[model samples]
Target: MAGLDFLNGELEELKRQGKYRLPSVWESGSGAWMDIGGRRVLQMASNNYLGLTDHPRLKRAAVEATEKYGVGAGSVRTISGTLDIHEQLELELARFKDTEAALVFQSGFTTNQGVFGTLLQEGDVVISDELNHASIIDGIRLTKAARRIYKHKDMDSLEQALRESSGYRTRFVVTDGVFSMDGDIAPLPQIVELAERYDAVVCVDDAHASGVLGRFGKGSTDHFGLHGRVHIQIGTLSKAVGVVGGYAAGSQALKEYLIHKARPFLFSTSQTPAVAAACLEAIRVLQDSPELGERLHASASSFRTRLQADGFDTGVSETPIMPIVIGDSARTMRFSARLLELGVFAPGIVYPTVGEGKGRVRFIVTAMHSDEDLAFARDALLQAGREFGLV
Candidate 1:
């Protein structure tokens, strides 16, 4: 306790800098609208893209699995944790992605860590996009492989990075399918072309794109029609799936290798039966009801267009994740708080989450939001923006 006294000074500094904060207490499920601090607000800040977190089918599947398999997986997959449901989920994922096979991980972040750590070695070189998710950066950092970062979505920069890394035994090109902050999609077609030319293995982190892109939400690779051309496809079961887990879809050999070598998969406990069942049902629901994604895209387009027309900077976003850039960190926080006051629950993303002077309030458009819900959110945002002199 004596040695940790310096934490008090750090906390004070964070507060002074307008960075210290606590998560809001959500009093309801992560639906299009939720109750927070006794106030019912339109929830536009979560990753529940399809709003399947509270879907009846998912809930039913979870309950059934809980009854059948109890609560936990009890241990890691490599030991006694692997269950029939887990295998079924992986099979379903592989079929959904059109991959030879697939492997599941504890979370999206862990999937990145596992794949990067297991695949890349001392002589390998990983070429990444500059704005890839932090999980990707951290995963690449954990490996002994050399890392090269290209400018975000710049194909020429990616090619140069590829050329420079040609000498390495294995050239791995990694990128996020949908960049979380700016919401811009990666130039996967160009990336694939370059990777082909350089013989680099293409690894796409489709955490945000999985349930938001492609036919029936197969993901970015399928959206671009790259399919089997891309070697590795990493996805999350949490975001659009409305559950908790991550996965890697690719060749059978890759799945075999990661199962044996990926430290995260080998060490972490398998997903709970309920979670796996719910995720499996989520995929089925997506396939059964493609209208959910269509509705989401349409709503997002309208909302984003409205914001842009209102003179708000919704940076390079071509997807549902919209970032209303508010240059100053404190101002962004103030804007977010004001939105809460106006019956919206969007959160502010600042500093380390984004670049300096790039603070913003991120809004995630979901399929569950009705026209009335979005209209309410739009009005609240504009009111808050006008007060801050943003519009």
Candidate 2:
């Protein structure tokens, strides 16, 4: 309590800079629209890419699971929490991912920690993209492995990192399949080719890519047809799957290895059986109907095209997650507030989430958004931009 006052000063400074994160209260399920601050608004800020959060099938699956099993697993997975439904979910996940095995974690962040902290050790090397997610960065930090970071999507730099790590016992090239803030994709096939030449393992965190890329939303590996070549494919059940949890799909040996060694998996309580059941049903729905993903990408593409044509700098986005770069953080925040006032829920992204002078208001397009919704969002963005002089 004696030193707590300093934190207030820091927070005040953030507010003065308009870099403070003031999250809105959401009173409704995420979909094409959401209730925020007692007002229903068009939501362009969610990761519910396929709009499965309110799907009757997913809801029914979750309800049935909660009825059959209690609300929680009640213990860590390594102890008394490995429910039968958990195994079933893992099996289905493996099948869906076309992998030999799968192990679910409490979250996407924890999944990264589980893999990196367990598989890497002293004398190992981790080659990461400079723009990889913070969870990946923290996971690498947890290991004693030598770390080398390459420029974003720069294969030459990646090769340089690999070349420098040749003496290590094991080398890993880690990247996000779809970069969340920028919405660009890592060149997985190229990364794989480099990893092969350098005898490195490849780990792609497909958190954003899942259910948004590939024929049936199998993600970057399947999108590029590099299934058997990649070593670790990490994903989340929350975003596109419209549930909650994370999983790493790989060889059977890999799953067994993580089961024993991944601290996050061993220490955290298992995902509730209901969540597992819902996620399982989500995969089944994706496999049964490919239109969901197709619609997602189509909607995103249309939005991005319209935004660019209407004079917004989309900043190299190729996926559903797109950013409207408004360099000054304060101005970006103002733009976002103006957007919210005008009935769009697109929020501002600021440093250090993004580079200095590159703060933006990121927009995520989902299948839930129709053509009318897209047009409405775009017009709001344009009006807000003009109001704030961001255009």
Q: What are the TM-scores, per candidate, against the unseen true structure?
A: 0.99, 0.98
lDDT of 1: 0.93
Best-fitting candidate, measured by lDDT?
A: 1
lDDT of 1 by residue, 148-188 (tens): 99998888888888878778999999999999999999989
Pairs with backbone N, CA or C atoms under 3 Å apart (clashes), candidate 1: none
Please give the range of 10 consecutive residues that has the lowest summed lDDT in model 2. 382-391
- Model 1 clash count equals 0
Q: Cα RMSD (Å) per model?
A: 0.8, 0.9
**Alpha-carbon deviation at 343 in model 2, angstroms:** 0.4
Candidate 2 residues 1-391, lDDT tens each? 9679899999999999999986688999888888977899999999998888888999999999999998998999988999999999999989888999999999999999999999999999999999999999999999898999999999999998888888999999999999999999989889999999989999999999998888789889999999899999999998999998899999999999999999998888899988989999999998988988888888888888888888899999999999999999998888888998999988999999999889999999998889999999988988887877766
Candidate 2 displacement at residue 251 in angstroms: 0.8
